[model samples]
Each structure stands twice: as C-alpha cells, then as structure tokens.
Target: MAAKAFQPRHQSVSRGIAFRLVSVGCYSVMAALLKLASEHGVVAGEMLFYRAIFALPVVLVWALRSGGVRALTTRRPWAHLGRCALGIAAILCSFQALIMLPLATATTVGFTAPIFATVLSVLFLGERAGNHHWLAVALGLVGVAIIMLPGGPANDTAPLPGVAVALLAALGTASVVTVVRQLRHSEHVAAIVFWFFASSALVGGILLLYVGKQHDLQTLAILAGAGFAAGIMQITLTESLHATQVSILAPLDYLQIVGALALGWLVFSELPGQSAILGGCLIISSGIYLIWREYRPQTIARRNLEANTV
Candidate 1:
C-alpha cells in the first residue's frame, strides 16, 4: 500500500472566515429552533436540558477526535465549575429572552458581550484600555441604551423584562469570556469544551426535574435540532479561532445579526424596529473598530516593545 500523506496543521485565513460564517449560520438556526420550541410551550429550563443532552454526544465525538478520551481530562476542575455555572446562567437568560423578544432584538442586545468583556478585562485582568478603547466602549453602551430605551415606535419596542434578561445574559457571557481567557492558559480547548458540556448536561438534567414539561414529537425534534446545531456551532467556532487570528474572525461574528434579522422576518414575521437597526450598527461598528485597533501591526509592535521594556 502507498504511504498516506500527512497533512500539516496550518492557519488559513480564508478557511477561518468560512468556518466562522458557517458557525454563525448554525447558531442562528439553533436560536430559531429554540424560539420555535418556546412557542410550543417549552420552558427555558427544559429547552436547556434538551440542548445540553443532545449536544453531549457531539461534544464527546469532537473531544475524542481532537485527542483521545484522555484529552477530556482537566487539572482545573474549580475553574471549569465556575465557568459552567456562569455559562448555564447565561444560557437560561438567553433562552428566556429569545422566547420573549424578537430574534433580532435579542441578538442585537446580546452584542453587548464584547463591550462588557472589555470593561471586565480592565477590572479583572489589570489590562489598561486606551482612550480609543474607552471611546468604543462608551459608543457601544449608547447603542445598548438606544435599544433598551422605552417607548420606541410601536413596532420597535420590546418587553422591558425581555430586554433586561438579554442584558443580563450578555453580562454573564462576558464573564464567561473573561474566565475562559484565564482557563486557556492552563487547559486544552477540547478539555474545556468537554467539561463544559458535561457540567451543563448535569446541571440541566437536575433543573429538568423541576421545570420540564411534556412536548409533542415535533417540538421534541425542534429542541433536539437546536441542541445539535449548537454543538456544531461550538465546534466550528473553536476551529475558526484555531485557524486564524481572532481579529480576523471577530467582525465575522456580527454576521449573526444579519442572519437573525432575516430569520426573524421570515420565520416569525418580526422586523427589527428602527432602534434595533440603529443600535446594532453602532455596536457592530465599535466592535469591529476595537478588533482592528487591537490587531493592527503598529499596535502589535508597540505592545511587544512595551513588554520588552518592562
């Protein structure tokens, strides 16, 4: 038999971009499925349970393929526990918001995660934000406020409770991102992902006992689909981050807003009001500018010089 050629693991910006877009599409689909299930009277806890349960097999397969079962082993159990708790809370709040708000509105509000993350980095990581960073953060907050402001045109308003929940979800997500930043120093990506799914499944399972409700087969299928899509999205996103610079991939995340807008209009007959569109633009522009600023060659060189001088 001929010898098989070994493939080298090399970064490909194009592939990373494609992977990111696919991941965004998968997430959009998952959100749509969750919304559909919610409409069928599925509780947020139950939806989370099924999402984690169905996603377990896929995450296991990913972990096994990335390394072996041993790759799932972790030395930082406490860190994972904290991350899982926050992640589960974020998921619960996100699901609740999705059920109550238009899809685009929920998604637009969720974009605040990066802005929250920036502030958290300053406070927790002792990282200093430049004037530009603070400017971006302020602009992003303004955008969030615009969306959350009361009494827009009738078609543009979302429930205050839903908006509040979504903002909470974004805060939780930012905290998760900050923790993951620390975890990446000590944990393999596969191990982190595996433990997250396992912990989430356990937590969701326990919660299910209290809040789970019966569902028709179709609703069950949709819930399962949501779980499956979430797993795929996670995998693709991980791969995308591995395959390219984060800045190259970061702006691509905004594509989800477009996907959500389209899905909302087509699937739910929901159109984002003026406030959402305006706020989304501000948030996305600020995020992209931050990413560009952080990744520019001059900024990179200056940071490296500072480190060397220190």
Candidate 2:
C-alpha cells in the first residue's frame, strides 16, 4: 500500500513552536538559577548533586506514567549509564562556565551543543547532513572565533578554565544526544530522563565528597531550587519533544540566549557587548537555518511514516 500523508492533526506547527519556546524558556530560567547559586560559592558537583536529588522523584513519576518501571530496565544499561555520565559532565562544565564567564557569554558558547550534536550524529549515527549543515558548521566556527578572541569586549581572563570545561561539556552532551537517537526507537524518553537524575545524583554525590562545602539550610534550599528548576526544564523539554521533532524544536533552544541576556542584565547587572550580541545572533541564526533545512523534509516523511503505521 502507498504511504499516507504526514499531517499533524492534533497539534498545529505553531503550537509545536510555542511548546518549544516554553521549553527553552524553562531552560533559560534554570540556567539563571544555576548561575545565581554558583555566585554564592556552590561548586558544580554540589550543585548538580542537589539538583539530581530533587529531580529524581519527579522523573520517576514521569517514567511510571510513560511506561512503568520496565522502561527503566533496558538491555542497554551501559549506554544509559554512559549517557548519564555525559550529562553529569556537561552540567559540571556548564556550571563552571557560568561561574567564570558572564551569563550571556557562557550561555552563547554552551549553545554550541546542537552543532556538536550534528557532527556526532554524522560520525556515530551515520546520519547524512546536507551542504547547509556544513555551511552552518563553518559559520558557527566563525561565531566561536568572534566570541573567543583575546581582549574582545566579551573576553574575560577568569573564564579560561570554564571555557575549556564548557567545550568538554559540549562534546559529552553531543555524545549523549547521539545515544538518545540510537535508543529512541526502543527506549521511552521518561526512562532516559529518569536515569539522568538517578545517575547524576549517585555520581555527583560521590564526586561532591571531595569538594563539598558546608552550607546552612537557607543556602541548601537555594541549591535545591536548582534541582527543581532542572526538573522543570527536563519536563518541558520532553513535553516539547512529544509535540515536535528535535530538529523542529532545536531552534527554540536559542531562545535561551535572550532569557540569559535579559536575566543577566536584570539580576546580575551583566551586559553583552555589541560584538557578543552580534556573534550570538549569527551563531543562533546559522543553527536554526541549518536545522530547518535538514528537518523540514524529514519531519514530513516521519509524519507520513506514522500515518501509514497507524
């Protein structure tokens, strides 16, 4: 039989975009909260450890609602654990970056996760990206250069280690995204997210033993808020995924720059220079354009495939 047409009857494309925007908004808020906590001297490991603790129960409920506990016991234990490790590393690096750099600048650099994800997908998943993606990659590199140039308006000597950590975070996160693609066919999204909290908690706790500082209840409460924010971000991300393809949702991730910039200015009194703003805009535009080019056709095809499957 011929395949059916791929049409989204329940949720319109605009709705999908709105959902993704909400998700990105949550992510930006979460990033701001993490940055705030860090300024008070919270170590990345400690911050993540607390965040994971708060997230575990919420994610557990999600896992149960999605597919019960069976979904958690996948045959691919190693893959899931590896993904969790990568997530922890990414959070650790990102928090470090946030602490050392201006909120807007650090966030702009960390937004490179999508590009890294694309490269990893091509290398590891054998996914074919067209010329537009390559062009996006090249332009993204230029954006990075603009942001990273020594003595640039956005440049800060303090963020050197943090910059390295953020790059490492990008690499690790890209690998996790590739792993997610590999497992998407078999694994439930909630299960993956659940493992993220569970594993990060356990691993981050172990790591925190070395660097953890004693904080009073009020400080602990603030740190715990980071976890709650992380949970909300994860839920938002998953819900957005349910409404649209990653490629469609990916561009919305750039909205974090706006939220971060605004929050940085309002809360932290930090402002992005003209160059930083211009470079961030170039990077975000290139990424969004590339994702749209690659995913628009593929999303249509996937919808058609689903219609036929039904």
Candidate 3:
C-alpha cells in the first residue's frame, strides 16, 4: 500500500524534473539572444523595454484566457511595484555584467540568487531552515569566495558593482517568489504574469526615455528576438514551477552557466579560467544539495495536494 502511494508521486516528480530541464534550455536560448542584442549596441534599458513590450501582449492573451481582460486586477499593487523595481534593477545590472564579463562567468555568479533567496526566506517569510540547509548555504558562499579570490573580478576590477547588483537581484527575485507563494491559491497564474509584464513595461518605458538611443532596423530585429525568447522562457519557467516545487526546479537554473559558457566559447571565445570553473562547481554542488534536502518534502506536499483536490 505504501509503495502504491509513493510510486505515482515519484513519477510526478520525475515529470516536473523533465519540464524543468526544458525550461533551462529555453532560458539558455533567451540568454544567448540577449547577448546577441547587447553586441548590436542595445542598451539595457532598450532591451528591457522591448522585453516588456513583447511580453505584455503574450501575457495578456494568457490573462484573457484565464479570466478575460477583467481578470488582470490585483489587490496588492504595492507588492507588484516592489517586485517590478527589484526585477528591473536586477535585469539592468545583469545586462551590464553580460557586457563586461564572459557570459558563462556572469551566469555562474548570478546563480547565487538561490542561496540569497534561501537566506531571505528565513528572515522575511519566517521559514525555518534545517542544519543541512545552513551547511548548504555556507558551502555555496565558499564557492562564491573561490570565484572572487584575490586578483579576481570581485577584487581586481569594478566587477564588484555588477556582482553586488546581481546579489540584490537575487534577493529581489526570492522576495517575488515568496510573495507569489503567499498568493498562489488566491491569484491566478495569468494575473501574476500579466501584472509583472504590465508594470515592468510602464516602468521600463519611463527608464528608457532617459537612457535609450535610437536603434537601426537590424538592431531592432535582434531586440525583438531577445524579447520573444525572454517571454517564452519566462512562461516555461512559470509552468515548470507550477508543475513542481521550487526546491526541485530552482537548482536547474544553475544550468544557465553551462549554457552561457558554451555560447561564450562558440560565439565570443571567452573561456573561463580554472578558478571560475572550480568555484562554479562548488557553488553548484551546494545548490544541488539544498535542492535534494528541500525538494523531498515539497514534492510530497504537492502530491498530497493534488490527490486531495482530485
């Protein structure tokens, strides 16, 4: 009887994992598109503008399907605003880092967001972490230290600003996710997606007016591709999370570094040094450990919820 109960849950978890892998692939493609647009002289603001613009229509269509156009309202406008601000800041810093560093290296550093998120959840959400989780977070930091060793980007150049920005972005992302978790049952997924895009587009447009330059037709086309890819990647990411626990799906995000590395090698010939690889491995190991520790219970809960709902 126990085996019968567990078998289907295991299968569901496996399916979620497969979807997450696909989501990671989509994100990799999106990152590559962003890199391509950046090379063509698109500022972070312009890229963001296009991303939000393209995302708005797609997200609205989703919103309409879920509840028509009227389904777009949110009682928590402040939450939406705060999330938009943090997300936009993160995007700008990340894009700037992409401009300066090897894509792979930047992506590896950016993966620190999960560790940050885990920590923030404890403080903000009052979620408790086990000793194993603490150990995982510690190990992740040590990995970051390895990446930021003496004569490294953290110490050698102005890369600290970018890194700091990335860290803040991670914190903001975690906050957004926590908020979403709180609203999971109350808010429709389409509503959440729509608000993010609409608020981001409005705010991004304002920012663009100050910093954006005119783009050539070719450049505009590249930006459009970036936006399209970003929207698709986001949709897949959301779907993956809906289908699984954050603990399971979040770690797969580290794969973005691998994608960035491959793209960097083939397109820009930017090879990461040995230290970066070593540090990245350590970081990834800790993240994987955290996922293993956290996901089991989350999967069980999700399976139970589904069973009860049915």
TM-score of each: 0.93, 0.88, 0.84
Off by more than 4 A, model 3: 1-18, 152-158, 242-248, 298-310
Give the TM-score (vs. native) of candidate 1.
0.93
Model 2 stretches astray by more than 4 angstroms: 1-15, 298-310
Best by lDDT: 1
lDDT string, candidate 2, 1-310, tens digits: 1111122335555677777777677677777777887777887888778888987777788778756777666767787877787777777887788888788888887867778887887887666777888889878767877776668776653245666676677777777777776666666666678888888889888978898888887777776776776777777666666665667677778778889889999989998876677667777877787678657877558756866887
Model 3: how large is the Cα RMSD against the reference? 5.6
Q: What is the lDDT of residue 285 in candidate 1?
A: 83
The residue-by-residue lDDT of candidate 1 on 162-224, one tens digit each, is 888998999999999999877876677788888888888888889889987778899999999
Worst 10 residues of 1 by lDDT: 1-10
Clashing pairs in 2: 51-227
Q: What is the lDDT of candidate 3?
A: 0.70
